[model samples]
Target: MKELTKQQSKVLACVEVYLNKTGFPPTRAEICKELGFKSPNAAEMHLRALEKKGYISIQSGSSRGISIVKSQQAFEKNVNQMPVIGLVAAGSPTLAEENIEKRIPCDPSMFSDSFDYFLKVKGLSMIDAGIHEDDLVAIKKTIDVKNGDLVVVRLEDEVTLKYFKKNNHNLELIPANKDFSTIEVDLREQEAFIEGKSVGLIRTH
Candidate 1:
């Protein structure tokens, strides 16, 4: 709802990622470390401004309790110049901040819809699908999907990448690894959420 300055947005974005990881907001010092601020007070100043403008809120006496208050709809529509890091899980959601490796510039037009962020691949889990470690997976931040699409999903609260299949009410996640078994879930038995579908890929070797 409120316009954030470039610095404010940068700091807030980092804070949001960190919060997703630790389940607690970052301290001023931690924020400084991530943003290259010379002093904790510099981070404090930015945090205060974000709070004053309604972008975030501070919980008294809590070290990691800063909360981001932006709406998902607004975030998707107004994402201008936001750095795309990698992809997050759709079948298995990983909100952990440490998984976010680096920031890469992206043209959001490459995706069919809005995406909140990107997750860097860490292993060869999807090598057969051409998704390698250190690759950047571009995901449109939406839940709607179809068969044969690559998706990031959270299974049992852990983030995973896979191709999706739906038959009646049975959901299946096919892995790229031949050694791995396909994960099947009954919508009535387990809860699964699709973070987004893989729209594009970035590779650097």
Candidate 2:
């Protein structure tokens, strides 16, 4: 797989999460919201980059034409033909499989170089991070992250996503919502685990 820049990787991960949750794809505005970008154009630029990098395929003028490439085997299975599902959102992961519309043909080569797995996004605590209610934030599993990186952290047995920041000798798990207070942990008090870093958002609605 090709190496992804920090920004590119984050956007891509968000996309995966949205897909797994809603079984659909996200719009550019939705992408901007989840990734903390000001303009949808930023999302569009990265998407184009994702397309150029062979991690995604975009159908111009269509909002639901985005698809991720899972494996080379699947890509080879259908050279120019693949499957397109219905519009997908990234908030809830517990939808009935029956809700899935028929699959349309697509190209897997579009997303051949991105990471694996999709995370279903829930809740709106991450709105400042652009993760709104029902947005699916795609994530790439990796233990590696620098201080202050936006991460999916399981704290106190609850799974929450936030930026990993440090203050003095304690670590700060900061939420995006102003209504929510930041979490401070003594390095010796307990352990904060990192599940993965976010890549992209797949908004369905």
Best by lDDT: 1
List ranges where model 1 is wrong by over 4 Å: 1-100, 111-114
Best by TM-score: 1
lDDT of 2 by residue, 46-156 (tens): 888888877788888887678875322333333453222222333222123333222223332334323333445555567887777755455556778668776776655
lDDT of 1 by residue, 1-205 (tens): 4567899888888887776677777899998999898899999999899899776788978877787665222344334433444444333433333343433445577667655567677667688987888777777767889999889777675677789999988999998978778999998998887878888776777
How does candidate 1 score on lDDT? 0.73
- lDDT (0-100) at residue 183 of candidate 2? 83
TM-score of each: 0.55, 0.45
